[model samples]
Target: MLILGAHYRLAFTHSILAFSQVINAATHYQLDYPDLALILALVRGGSLARASQLLKVDVSTVFRAVRRLEAALGQQLFEKSRAGYLPTTLAQSLAEQAERAEQALEAARIGVEQGGEVISGIVRLTCTDSVLQGLLLPALAQFMPNYPALTLELSTSNDFANLSRRDADIALRLTRTPPEHLVGRRLADISYRVCASERYLQSVNTTDLASLTWIAPDDFLPDHPTVSWRRQTLPGVTPGYRCNSMLSVTELVRAGLGVAALPDFLIGDGLRPLGEPLHGYDTVLWLLTRPDCRALRSVVTLFDELGRALKLP
Candidate 1:
């Protein structure tokens, strides 16, 4: 009976050892959070292009991530086809787990953001150059000094930053319809006016609208309101100058180069509006932030400050 008990104890010890080895081997390779995020995106989107779009990365980036994950796991996660990448069963399963982890991480982030009275950390904001120079910079100059610990970084872009991907913590944009996913309210109506310098107005026959030299946005800005407005307002008349930047157009008008439609916010000194705000080029200035970040103290504070400072009287 003593010998039988000794044999049973040896077998139990071996079983425990084997289980420990299995766990060690399983945990040897640490899965990257970025790779897991890519996997979840691919599983949800079902294609490399779709995943890239959702992740705000290049298609090659997603492809390389898949290869890296497969190599680390020593298993194939996806099968390539003409239709796109089809996730294997393991990929789907892992994605499900990763989604849960992602949710937990997001909740954790929100909790940390709302945890304290401290309004610190960097807040990234994206907007057009004109808005930065004319509207936001001044307001920020006054507001930022109050919060010494908080840092505000600005990125100027012609296109809207992808808030879902966290390209910027906040965005100030001029649009007729703001994106549904973002949280914000319109600050004020953005009105456009036909403006020119005193010198240009004096040189041209103001009475003869067709004969005056005109400044307009170049073909690169095909979707710009000025482009469409010019096409509709002056069918055959060619512009004297063309520029891709609205700020540059404003400068040209200020230099007495020609007349152009400019946003009301950009009508600084040295430029005068030739007429009342144009009829069809109505837009609004929207102050937007990610829904997840709405509760963040820094974001909330800046958002409220900008809303108050920028609201038109």
Candidate 2:
């Protein structure tokens, strides 16, 4: 009876050990470093062209790598549709794991480089094209050279990037309200003015704003605050030309094509103010950084410089 009991106990112990070994083997399976790199690059880039640029490889290479990964995984990582490569649940999980691995590697590298007193690292920033061209460019010129060891990656997009996913380290946004997840300072209250070229104004009745030809944002920017403001301020008025780009709208207005509500910063020597600044169309500028990133020396330094420079008078 004792021998029988001992045999049962030994079998149970062997089963447990086998289970642990299986888990360990699955978890520590030799990961293909190149495939991991490709996955991370594609996930971050959002498109093939962008991924190619990031990976310094051709589009075909990216396509081949993605196909190979999908085949090996025996599951579709991304949905290929008209909207482009939308990540599947599996892809998200894989990408997140890859990100963690990359972060660990970066931490190791930074740990090794800690001997240097200089604050040196990469900081990714995202903002609208207008902000990039008008506000951030000058600010970066001053801030970047001051930190010779730091590198900046600027991404321009009309829509907000997902900061929680580390899409960017910081964001410069114009909004009446900032996102709850982000931590930042309200930099300024931005306002837009009704403006047109002198020649354009002469061609229309400035006294009756509703009667003037206007250039406005197209369907692409359906939720543009100006669109609602225009509808309320000038009922029955439709724009003479529709464009997606604010810069293009300004140029069209300057070419005597139509009048537009141009932002205060963009109102320069060429345009003449027609009316008092529009109400209910004002938005505040915010310089935002993730809570986790605020402690990083490079992020804090750039945040301070931008805060000082972009703050409203």
Candidate 3:
């Protein structure tokens, strides 16, 4: 009985000692070099010899960096084989943290050098193709002159831009209700009218919905007022031609393919609005962003400029 108790006590004490050592080792390993040192050396420099030359350090210095990184991580972060020092599972898991750290560090460096200077960080805006054509480009042309140092990168995608995820700094959307976790401001209650080319008016009568050929956008947005009107009024109606972009739809309709319902902003000077008014086709344009980005100067400026550009006389 005494021997068994002693053995049990010894095992428990050793387990506690092992756990304490793990915590101590983890706390002691401090990384002094810049973030992504190991990964950058491995990817860009290719081998230790080339990496050391590029990093302006000795080969053993690079080796020690790898060792220190592994020690800091308290894991076998890499393995030496005939091929090279291959990263272990833990290194791969920490990849995103390293990248994020590098970005934060870059932001810090920029802040230090450009302190009290004008705004200069790149502004990434997410906009729909339609908004890009109708609102963003013209607004940007006018707004950019005011802020010379700020750079703009417009990302035009139909997918909902998750502002919290940094998908875009700002977005222009048409919605009656703003989504949760987003800050939305109503810009305009945008109206549209049915219009067609003069050639099409001469060839076909578009006074009524039936027996009138129409050109429509290829992808149907469920919330689109015109699309909803068409589905509600003319269920079996199929257009002669369908294209994705508003530009394509306008061009196809202008070619006298068929009459199309278009926003006045998208219409050229030549096209005439039809007399017949479609119901359930008025929508409100909105500017939206995550709360954090909404406070950003770039996004707020975009909202202000874009809202001004969208108004029609």
Candidate 4:
């Protein structure tokens, strides 16, 4: 009986010591929220320069913050190599926890911001430049005046904004598949058509499409549907002009510079459709927001308004 009782005491003592060590470690590492944010961004970005861009700080600032974090923790969080900074196992675990904390903090902030009865706050919207000019801005011009207290900020980028990180409150994107985490619906089916100015069509032989001067998306957009379509359908034909911007290609088509494939919605005023909508190149336009932000009055109002205005018949 004495031996069994002694064994139990030994186990209890070890448990207490282990608990104490955890407490001591926790007390030793006094990590700030901003530090945690930096860690998360670094893990996501995989480079100091990219992290700095995400955090809106200088590269030196990001580097110093990382060094400070390592000093506090007494361990390296990342493996630096020529390729990029790779997160250690410990860093990945910490970043996961930090992400959860970030989401909670963002939820709380949204709750407080929406607590007031007035639907007034900034809603940051992000989308590609073509979508901004061809679709959203026109609808927003009509929608914004209705909400006098609200402010709408726009960000144009080809890459989808990271909605999980609250990079933007709302996003309008053209994709076959929208991120599952975002709350939204497909607004419209985007179809492409061969388009040119009426004068260009009259000037060129309509019977031989391969012989006409073609305007194409530049090598920068090699993966663009029109680029692939032109390459596959027309084979040996070469374009007369190439542009990096889809909007610019549309403008060139309207100016009679050359014929180009354009989304049906962009075939406005001076442009005329030369052929039917292309097959297997249809994409859907989506209006999306973080699930947490969907409940915000301002976001909800703008989301609904944009949905209604942008939905194609």
Q: Identify the leading candidate in terms of lDDT.
A: 4
Model 4 TM-score, all chains together: 0.60
Measure candidate 2: CA RMSD: 12.3
Misplaced by over 4 Å in model 2 are 1-116
Local distance difference test scores for all models: 0.77, 0.75, 0.65, 0.79
Across residues 195-243, which tens digit of lDDT does each residue of candidate 2 receive? 9998877667777888888899898877677787898878799899999
Write one digit per residue (lDDT tens) for candidate 1, span 25-98.
66466555576788889998889899999999999998888888788777788998888888887787767666
Q: Give residue 244's error in model 2 in angstroms.
A: 1.9
lDDT of 4: 0.79
The TM-score values for the models, in the order shown, are 0.62, 0.62, 0.60, 0.60
Q: How many clashes does the backbone of model 1 have?
A: 0
**How many residue pairs clash in model 2?**
0
Off by over 4 Å in 3: 1-116, 311-313
Candidate 4 lDDT tens digits, 20-117: 34322644765556877898999999999999999999999999989987887777889999989999877887687666555434433433455523
Q: For model 3, how does the per-residue alpha-carbon lDDT over 139-214 read when each residue is reduced to its tens digit?
A: 7787677655556777876555556677777777766666777876787776777888888788776657567888
Poorest lDDT segment (10 consecutive residues) of candidate 4 = 1-10
Question: How many residue pairs clash in all the candidates, one count each?
Answer: 0, 0, 0, 0
Indicate the TM-score of model 2: 0.62
